[model samples]
Target: MEIEPYVDTTLDEPLVPEPPEPGSILSESVIDELNMTVWTLSNGVTVWLKPTDFKEDEIALQATSPGGWSNSSLEDHQSAVIAAGLVQQGGVGAFSTIDLQKALAGKAVQVSPSIDQNTEGMSGSASPEDLETMLQLVWLYFTSPRQDETAFQAFMAQGRAVLENLGSNPMAAFADTFSVTMAQGHPRSRPLSVAILDEIDLETGVDFYRERFADASDFTFVFVGAIDLDIMRPLAEQYLGSLPRIERVDSHVDLDIDPPDAHIQKTVRAGVEPQSQTIMAFSGPFDYTAQNRVGMRVMAQALEIRLRERMREDLGGTYGVGVTGGYEQIPEESYTVTVAFGSDPLRSEELRGVVFEELRKLQVEGPSQEDVDKVVEGERRARETNVRLNPYWAAQLIGAKASGQDPRFLLDTTTIDAVTIESIQEDARRYLNEDRVVIVTLLPAEMIGRP
Candidate 1:
């Protein structure tokens, strides 16, 4: 048999099979203030349901629970980190990769499971008509994950090809060193390399994945879209409620991943292209709360405006600049703020001086009233739009749940509406303290007299 790339476009028919039916569920409680419904299955799974008419035929779901690579034992640590990616490559349940594709030839549905530093779960979407197939896939993923050796070897081979001659790209050298330095010698923080391939095996990766998703008691599944509470209840209970349930207390383990304690600086040289880049990072311990999180967001937005003004507009040194800073709640309560941009190697020193000058201004005086107002206005508009979207609600609830943050904060707009100059300055001083800072400069390789 030969493969055919052409489709039979002349046929007036859909190749898709029939969709699955909905399930029944009982509501535990309804919070009118949040306009949300909650249900607890007999098997210990929690479901958060919010109905919306945003899209006529769309729904988004995010199921999450505590425990990630951070919770793995030393023997399974490396495998756990890449477990989600590897497991997904192999087909789920009783379907081979090709068989699964053939089965889902014309369906608008997708589901992916992933494990990060502090969380593991499923993220997927489907039309209301196909919700049953979506849930069916979910149940199969947890109960019967396939361990196909052929798929595993193929994934490994692809990995080797990607890692081979990776250093040929200049950014590769700079990025590798930057990651190792930020990890501060934490064994688990090492970047993926060829050696990692040897340390991790197919069976170990699949085994770790099973252990992470084995228990559904701690997981919270949020469904938002055009939903009929009456129609979805039974389907959710049948597929999701039936997932493996075990009695266990699970949480992310602290591997002591810390940034440099003192101010440190390093320079990297790579590639032949005439380009250079610089990154300035600052981090320290701080109060992790909703109000503080909003405040930090405001400060970062304002700082970016000022940097864009000076680095690109005033000096005309680079094309653009970016500032990213936020507080972490899981495994540790800490903050990190970083500013980076590209410039000529000769002017790198001059531009370096400018970066610190801006830093000093932000630390002492904060952005202008106009800048603060601009940031708040933009944020208000974004929130206004975000609150109406389903994905926004799904991400907010699941992320807050995973990080141990207060989900009630999702409805609070007082902080964003009441942002002041003094508050921005205070947040800057508190989180971006100078004690913990790492600066890295990336310059082009040698070239003496090229005109």
Candidate 2:
């Protein structure tokens, strides 16, 4: 499949669209305690503006809306993944990929579209002076997404080459196996393979992109950092307000992907290296709430500290350990806590036993005051730093609104401070059930002798 050759279409003068009248599209702006302004645009696109001197000449912009992979069927999942990458490679409107690069030359502006489990949107940063250019690019993406067969084939060829030997790599195989195990045979959880890539149609992927981004009304645009409302309003009206609006109210559809109910243990023998990787996952249906989410995070941190001490220092078994906990909002609201480590294949079982012991200890004795204090202080410092940044606010506001929570929740720190040892212990007791755990181990073929 040969791609269309790039042709130079440079002209003596570049065409630029005229800005719309700012006064025509009125907005209702509400100033919050954190000095952020929430503006509801006439076209139903909500805009969150936080003017700051954090950076002298830069601003961050994020536009997000729900209905991502949730909008895709089992057969179309691979297309959804390829379409996001194709959008950037295919360029925007009439500009070829190289031509688009030439058009953006010498400008510190970047914008890219992406899709996840529950949302799809674009995010980018630009200099204050180049805000119009940023909005223009965004407008082009939503209005005229180019479908270049050449770019699509090229991207697929590159992806195929990379994935050709992916299964031969032990870590990659483990990751694939782990995903399937956690998802319990859900169609969306299937690992990417050459067979799956072969099924992707360039035209179908492009059409999927168009269908997902068809309605711009549901999107909320968040802009933060060195911004003046007077300068931003016109650009917002011209590019965002002028977007094609449809009477469509779209949200993600739950596909009902859930973890296995009973405990599972799987061991994979691969690669030639003399090492083993182990993952212990505990998950269950959880009520999605602000306080519960905070408690899970705090519990993960406390557990991480204890794991590092026992696994790395005391036993000298592994170089390091990783622990993470989070709740997913789609399918059904559920939380997972995972602890993973790499160690000698011969001692894999022993090290895993120690990890379980620590969990049992946390359940029985609970974390100490010192452990709670360390996590709280670390969280406080992180919150203080993130509050001053634009990307942080952009992500926070988008997530809050999508989950039907108040944007003001970003400003509330009561939950973080309220996390006590008792609360974390209670959460641990409820979530970390031995009967519901999933343990997966990957060992070298030589160490475990393939059956």
Candidate 3:
């Protein structure tokens, strides 16, 4: 038997390239701490380039600017959200979505547009050889985003279909209630519904997308992995440098969204599954600092370890429990700690008490030295491997720039030493507040006889 190598016919006869108009790099800055270089283009686009031989064929890129949909009208939040989403589905430049796919058939290049609460941008990857193609797509997304009515209609139809049956799902009902309750009546925080979907217009989305991406002045572009500075500089200039810009920079606008300052509990009964689920949350104002951020994670990881032991290993109450906690600086400086899990409908209250008792114990007596050390050791092992990788560097590099943190911290392991049992206990006391706790539980609808 003989096997022949596969050939991509599309690649054998490549489509004509749509190269960006020529432009030049205006200036450069070297952050000696991180061994990365930053360049400002003639047209004001900033690029952070980190060269690494981590992977021979890998390059990851992210270009983001402040002023996500929140910067748009809060009343039109759904439209702004849909606009960011439809850009990728609709198409870019002269290519239809299908045409673009066909054109990119054999290229190791990909990119997608996104809009989040405080930022909007593109994130994707390409092989080193396909970097120029990646740049071309980036330029097209900025210059000429196309709209497809068919795609728009299909997207909305699918959305409507999902919303139509959402009321019948216990998890969906619980989530909607949880989100609305936590957001404290913020209009922008409402969950998806037929009414919300009906008010969103594709045309409105397209317009908002254009406005958000219209200017590249405030955008910071990050590229990492297998970088060839000599090769990328000109491509960046030609593609990103030539992007349209007005005399404007964008910043995130807070919609004043925040969780409430009081404790409350609510239960939703739905579904046929004979089970119980609960989300116990604690939140309050926070002082967003580097030390506090790491401390919060240490506390959460330690708590996760405690929960797995008390609720799973010892009590045999359930198979697993989930614990997550983090602080946010945007809109307001605040933090949320959430513990969630499923268990027997009869034992839900008992399990909930276990969680509270463990939390209070940590706050009073602190985690053992072994628990703190485990978290630090795990972080060390992870970071040891992460430092040699591309995506980690890509994220951390951008994060350092965004937070004004010293880039040299990327190499400083001294921070981990600060994670002691005493510190963890102090973090528990400082951050976690039972006064702000919100407990939302879900049980079998028939079991509760319809709450």
Q: What lDDT tens digits, residue by residue, belong to model 2 across residues 200-302?
A: 8877777888888888789888888899989887788778887767898888888777788878999988999999999989999899888888888889998
| Structural similarity to truth (TM-score) of each candidate | 0.92, 0.94, 0.94
Clashing pairs in 1: 23-233, 23-234, 23-235, 24-233, 24-234, 25-233, 25-234
For candidate 2, the TM-score is 0.94
Write down the lDDT of every candidate, Cα atoms only.
0.81, 0.83, 0.85
Span of ten consecutive residues with least summed lDDT in model 2 = 11-20
Clashing pairs in 3: none
User: Which pairs of residues collide in candidate 2?
Assistant: none
> Which has the higher lDDT value, candidate number 2 or candidate number 3?
3
Over 153-230, each residue of candidate 3 has an lDDT whose tens digit, in order, gives 898899899999896888998898898889887999888898889888888888899999999988889999989999
lDDT of 3 at 238: 85
Q: How large an RMSD does model 3 have?
A: 4.6
Q: For candidate 3, give the lDDT of residue 347.
A: 83
Candidates ranked, most accurate by lDDT first: 3, 2, 1
TM-score of the candidate numbered 3?
Answer: 0.94
